[model samples]
Target: MDLPAKTKNISVILQKPKYAGNIGAAARAAKNMGISNLVVAGSAKYDQEEIKKRSTHLAADVVEKIKYVDDIRAALDKFSYIVGTTARKGAARGPFFTPRTIAEKITAVSQNNKVALMFGPEDTGLTNDELRYCHAVVVIPSSRKFTSLNLSHAVMIMCYEILLASLPACAEIPPKLARSSELEDMYEQIKTVLTRIGFLNPQNPDYWMTHIRRLFNRTSLLARDVKIIRGICRQIQWYNNQKNT
Candidate 1:
């Protein structure tokens, strides 16, 4: 069966994944769940033969079309919404949702925005720095004693929920939002202006920026909203210049 139109906008990203077979298996899982866009971030080299061995002939097309980028930010810049998967949880890594919940949310966001589901390396899931790029975080439920999941297995579970969510008809589709690239630019400007005014600690600005990111992520900022915030930053910069003169 063909995937829902909105579901076609979803992309799966693997960051610094360690194994070729895992990548291949992940590709097959994504294809099985009607997700064709697969992106790999990081410079790790993998044996094509091993990858093909795992993906097999059924997912050859997915393997052939997999996108490769040098880093996670570049891989995700064009996407408007990004979800990061993690096994371990902490205060900083929080506000995590189940796969089903996030999948439903993605269904709505994917209606008008490009969505990315990002998974990290097999040994260690996404780090805090990497999770900063994600708008949301999802954790797969498992036994407490053995909470960790295999790389491809984790991909399969998330993909399955997204496919299930896409099966239903959606009544409301949101308007397109600002892409990650745009948001990042606005954030940089905000950070620079805020630091100039001492609103954010120059020694540890990102500590406070996390709160700012959380605020905007929850609001689901649109392109226009980003422009407004950036406009404010520009005005602040102008005021600072006037004061200096």
Candidate 2:
């Protein structure tokens, strides 16, 4: 039977995963639970063939579309809500939720915006530096000495629980596509205009394009919005040209 579209905001992000097998199995978990997107952060393994071999014929969709990112902050900060999965004890306040509670937090955020659920490296779990990016840290309820779980297994267990819990109360979530090409075109026009007006230095622009790309992606832009933006850019650029020459 074909699975329904995922309605929750939870997206599992693997940080610098070492083994292709682990990524493959993790994809299977997300796929089995009907999670569509799996994001990988850092200079990591995201090869299709390797993941396919490890997936064992499951989660082919996730394995095929896996995205790799060099910037951890860009990956984590893009989403409004975030959760860090780690079994380590903490001195300060943190909700030590069961797998069910982890699902709950995901649900709570799903009502509004996107979420990033992060898992750490293989040998060690999430580092303190990475954990700080998360709004809350979740500790899977387990034995004290052997509380830790394998990277992929932990994601699978959590994703499965979330998917199971949400099935009963699931509603129809319409498709949200990122047809961002129009936005990209508008940015190009904006850059041209800014350069013409001397607002943006073309010769020695300090990563301006990169920042603009990030900013544009951050906004929930639609195709129609891009058309309007393009027109505005043209008008402004024309006005600037007329004023000067």
| Inter-residue clash pairs, candidate 1 | none
| Residues 1-245, model 1: lDDT tens digits | 76574766899999999999999999999888888889999998889889889999999999999999999989999999999999888989889999998887798889889999999999988999999888899989999999999888898999888878877777788889889999999889999999999899999999999989888987788999999999999999999999999
Error at 35, model 1, angstroms? 0.5
Q: Model 2: per-residue lDDT, tens digit, 1-245?
A: 22332344557889888787788888787777767678888875456677888776667767777778885666765565566788777653244566786675465445555767788888887886676555556787777778768787888787776765665544543223223234445667878887777777889553465455445544545456667878888899788879988
Candidate 2: count the clashes.
Answer: 0
lDDT values, one for every candidate: 0.90, 0.67
Error of 2 at 12 (Å): 0.9
RMSD of each: 1.0, 8.5
Best by TM-score: 1
lDDT of 1: 0.90
Q: Where does candidate 2 have its weakest 10-residue lDDT segment?
A: 172-181
